[model samples]
Target: MSRQASRRARSIALFLVVTMVASCGTLPRSGPNKREIFAGSVLQEGDAFVVSVNPRVTAATAVVPALGFSSVFRDAGELGADTIRPGDTLGLIIYENVEDGLLTSTGASASLIDEVQVDSSGFIFIPYAGRLRAADSTPEQLRRLITRRLDEQTPDPQVVVRRLAGDGATVSIVGGAGAQGVYPIERPTRTLSAMIAAAGGFSIAPEIALVTVTRGNRSETAYLSDLYKNPHMDIALRNGDRIFIEEDTRAFTVLGATGTQNRLEFETETLSAIEALAQVGGLNANVANPTGVFVFRNEPEEIARAVMGRDDLIGTQRLVYVLDLTRPNGMFDARDFVIRDGDTVYVTEAPIVGWNRSVAAIFGSLGQVTAAGSAVGIN
Candidate 1:
């Protein structure tokens, strides 16, 4: 080939290289590469805080959403099985020494009063005892009070008070439990865990089962497994308390150059960053940049302040944490780092990938150029 023609071909190749290099951003990619991400660092105009993963950062951001009962749940005392309350039914059997006593039938020394309902005011009345406070008193205590009131009208009165199944003290179990129903707060089921067991336990796996106890205006939640590990979570249940058991809905999104991009639910009570990667089959080995794994999250003000070592940031701050698995302690840092809900895990492509594609494109274009030059007999 002549020198001028060779120079023309060389210039074409150089132009192709420059064009390819300049258009790297237009290349098909899952997300931004490491350099592009670093370009948006906190020092830049973007408000997002970009931080490198390390032991200190991992420790500061290793928090999992707290799942357990609060002080209001733990401090409340348990209700007694026999404590009388409104809406409860009392079964009273009165015995008199003389036949045909005040409350007895003709020629009978005993009388049975079944289904004696306590009024909303917590008072119950007998033919001779009149109105007596029945709520807040145990069966034996109510029996004594009834006898004291009846003794003035009958001689040697004997009384027995039996608390029957009623709606006075009960809890409602709903959602992912083996059986969903309203259960009474009886002797065997006075606490939260016991009531759950009485409802045939949770339907989901214990590791992912979340139990929420709602009493009045407040509610608290804890993992079913946590209830077994921490006794304090097995709080005493109150009447009208509602218990809901459900699978953990926490999940993080995996995107970018990972093996697969999908939203994955938490597999355990606490999921680590490494574990979350493993769930999606780890990073794509071919194009993934081992030093460019990042977790994007909107951290609360308190955690954001602690992570960036700044006090001025407010509200939920966007944070992007970079992880370099090529470093000595990178694997450990990932293991210690916690993956929270609604987080996005991204793995950037290697820098060489873009260069490889550009080179391939240039060679293909060069073949086309040579074919046209030979057709015109330039060589």
Candidate 2:
């Protein structure tokens, strides 16, 4: 062969070798070990009992009697307006006409005293009336007490008692909400949304927002999202009730060549596989083998038997779902695949691509060495 032709052939061979190496390097090895991946699998799909976004409360369903300043005084059967409870601060106003002689000057003299905090004993101290029973007594009732006391000394004494501070009949919100604090219910009626707002709203994602409400000794779980979607489920809050926001216990894991490899937490009630993938920044476009995405979940065998027998699963049952992303129709099926808490999604790399990349690197190094030798020879 001619010298120039021989050199050309050698260059072509080198190029082919480099190309093959690069292609080989790009391909992944044996995909991820199926057993290992399955062992670490944390993905599953099932109906999870979660708190309803708009939880329905049997107590809140019925119309709550209006309890206000005047309502307490009215003889109507409306729960006679809620009275001042323990840990309440109240204010009082006393108005005396100048002709009453109780005041040195005339002209409807009035005295205002604030911060009359109710003690644990349910009593508040009045300027001249001494300690009066306030806990469980309506503002009107308290006003009557003050008026009766002053009536003995003066003709027609008018008194007013109002709650100035201390959650003016509030519901305490605890647990997973944005702010865990007491929410005040000013009117006789307040809804779940109002209570949530008073507690600074929910901090966790709505998909996983679980809330529990405890009234008296009874506790019930509710989903805030569902409640929001269906207004009919929205329940009113009552006095002496405590609300708790709980952390989402359900979660799924995304592994392999995805953009982010971590356990993605979600509410078992609403997350689908497609949605979960989007949440984790989607699969790694360059490395993900569109045809080899798989999801492994623990499928409880004899679930019916277990339910009938009340048997607890000790990890005896499981299932694996392999999905192909390359097929156009597969996307639709994938979209409907719901993700359960503890489900594991694995995205494998295309084998040929890894092999190609490795081969490319080897040939690239050889080219560099060859070029260096040529430079040295020329010098």
Highest TM-score against the true fold, candidate: 1
Residues 1-379, candidate 2, lDDT per residue (tens digit)? 4667657755765777667665764334535643334444333233321111111211111221121212211222322344587777888778775454563255547877778888877887876667889887888888999888878877777888888764646788887777887766655336776678766778887766777767677666666675677664456666677888776677788987778888877745667567777888888877777766777655554432232233554544554565666676567656666666677887777766666767666777667756764665521
lDDT of each: 0.88, 0.63
On residues 1-379, what C-alpha lDDT tens digit does candidate 1 reach at each position? 7889877876786587668656764656677888888788778887788999898899898887777888988988888877888889999999998877998889888899999998888999888899999999999999999999999998989999998865788899999998999898888999888988989987788988998888899988888888889898789988789999889999999998888999999989889889999999998889999899999999999999999999999799999999999999999999999999999999999989978877777777776776776787755
CA RMSD of all predictions: 2.4, 11.3
Which run of 10 residues does model 1 get worst, by summed lDDT? 20-29
List where candidate 1 sits over 4 angstroms from the true fold. 1-25, 371-379
Judge candidate 2 against the unseen true structure and give its global Cα lDDT, from 0 to 1: 0.63
Q: State residue 200's C-alpha deviation in candidate 2, in Å.
A: 3.6
Error of 2 at 155 (Å): 17
